[model samples]
Target: MSELLNNSHRRKEVLMKLLMRLHEGESPDTLRTELAETLKGIPYAEVLQVEQEMISLGMPAEEVTQLCDAHSSVLSGLVDVGDAKAAPAGHPVDVFQQENKAILMTISQVRQELNTAIQSSGEDFKKSVIALRTHFNHLSDVDKHYKRKEFLVFPVLERQGLTAPPEVMWGKHDLIREQIKGIHEILLNPELTAEELQPVVDLVIEPALYALAEMVTKEEEILFPMCMDSFSENDWAQVHEHTLEYGFCIVDPVGNWKPTHTAETTAAKVESEVQSGHFQLPSGRLSAAEVQAIFNSVPFDMTFVDNEDKVKYFTQGTERIFSRNRAILGRNVLHCHPPASSNIVERILEDFRSGREERAAFWINMRGKMIHIEYFALRDEEQNYLGCLEVSQNVTRYRELEGEQRILSYGEKKSD
Candidate 1:
């Protein structure tokens, strides 16, 4: 039995057969039992290989995506991770796992509150709904978690020809995102009663939470371990560097991680580029130092998304209303926003790309400050769309200005 399990060809064949059975509508419970009895444990890599092979053999990626959860459930405790590498403290994978732990804890709390709401009535149920809403809001933070994986980790995997898994996982991510959005919409009704909320809890809420938890399991047991085995130290270092842009989920990484081997850091590379030469614009030429200083000196935060929808540049203003980091440099602009907001972003991008809109503006009160944000469609001489530019500024002082001073006020003091 051990020798047969050791044979990679045979193991993958058996795994593929079981997964195909699941695709054919076999019961997950029956498959789980069969996997346990027949395979005992399958290497995590074989699981990915089998999926890739299936796709290569003419199975539509959508079909594989549809079967993702079912197969993951069937192989829940059956993936062999005995040889998985341990991530160093503060490594990207380590941080991802830590965030998963925090997400799981939040899920547990939500379940407890759900149980309370299930047995209660009237105000008590309303209170439970409020609690559930707060928990679900926290769960929405999982968007950042998924974005980091989608923008940073998945690209690296794709470059290695490990494309199918990311596609399947991204489809699952979208499904989970839609589920969370649906739950939010249902929870926002002011007239919702306990009777109305019960069906939603059973249908929408539980399923969303289950999907969220299941993805975490897939990441830790299969994805992360496989990445650790496949990626070089430098690959991890780059991932760690870019992680700050999407931000952490529930917990921040404890410390910094870098490869032991000497290599040029991102900061050092940037410095080298800055010192190399000048950037000649269509109107004027400026040294890299001058350009950097000008961007940083700008009062408003500015970000430019290229025609391809990738984040290409952002100003580094000292008092930015929104955070910016190099990690977001190549990320899709849509992925930079939460799932709830991505729809709005997509709409704006479409309008800009189609020349239907030139600009969009919005304002909100944040931490007692009124912030103004606007997006502009960039065009060339021929009116061809180049990209989108986002500008944000704190307009609290401007809004509160009583009157304009006739004279210079740089060193003037006002009397109360």
Candidate 2:
């Protein structure tokens, strides 16, 4: 038995047979016991190879995806990782793992809230539900994590001829995303009763949470280890460089990772060229540095969402009412706000796109200051909708002003 397990070809053959049995509707519990008795520990790489082989040998990728969670459950705690390479503190894999840690922490809190909601009644139950909503909102940040993998890591894996796993994993990502959206819809009801919440907890909430946690397991046990083995240092460095474009999930990366062999990345080179050139417009031209300075020098915060609803740009002012980071670049604007308010954002975008609304404005008291926020529909000379611009400012002083001040009073103190 030891010799058979040690032989790579025989080991994979055994794994393939067992997985086929699993595909044929054998109980995971039964198969798990049999696998333990036969092959004490299957290498993670062999499992992946068997999956790839199955796909190459005529099993549809969709079937593999359907069985993904089932097989992962069976192989849970049974895959060997003693020989997996360790990631350095600031490496992209390390950052991904850290984000998983943060995600797991949030999941733990969500479970605690779930338990509390199950055990409580009335306002206490409502409070627990609200807490769950907040945690899930944080969980929604995992979209950024998944996006980084999809946009950065998956392409490299495909180039390496390892395509099936990424496809299967991306399918799983879409499933989790839809589940999270459903969970948000359920949690959005402010007056949900404990009795009403129990069914949701069992049917929708628990399943979603399980899917989330299981994906983390798949990532750490199989995906990250395989990527660590397959990707070159330069590949990792490139991934680390663009990670911020989609943003981090729940937590930021701890340290910066740069390849010792390469001095400049493609993004940096492009940025350098832009900085050295002028940005030409119909009526005027400004250097890149000057344009950036002018934007930052403005008093209010400005964010531009492109026609595709992706966040294209944001200005960094000295006193920004809301925070902005490079991580939000190219992200769907809908995902930027809390789920409860997403409908409002969607309505505004729809109205702007349809030309039914040119502008929308609102004001609120936040943190002892009056904040004014407005959204404007940007259009071309031909009246074609281009995008949407969001402007926000603290208008407390403006609201309190009794008389207009001239330029001569710019540096003068107002009378008490």
- Among these predictions, the greatest lDDT belongs to 2
Tens digit of lDDT per residue, candidate 1, span 18-112? 88889999999999998899989888888887888999998999998877888889999999999999988888899888889989999999999
User: Residue 130, candidate 2: how far off, in angstroms?
Assistant: 4.6
lDDT of each: 0.84, 0.86
- The residue-by-residue lDDT of candidate 2 on 230-313, one tens digit each, is 888888878977776777777656776556555346656756897999988998999999999999999899999999888888
**Model 1 backbone overlap count:** 0
| Candidate 2, residue 93: lDDT | 93
Provide the global lDDT of candidate 1 against the true structure: 0.84
Q: What are the per-model numbers of colliding residue pairs?
A: 0, 0
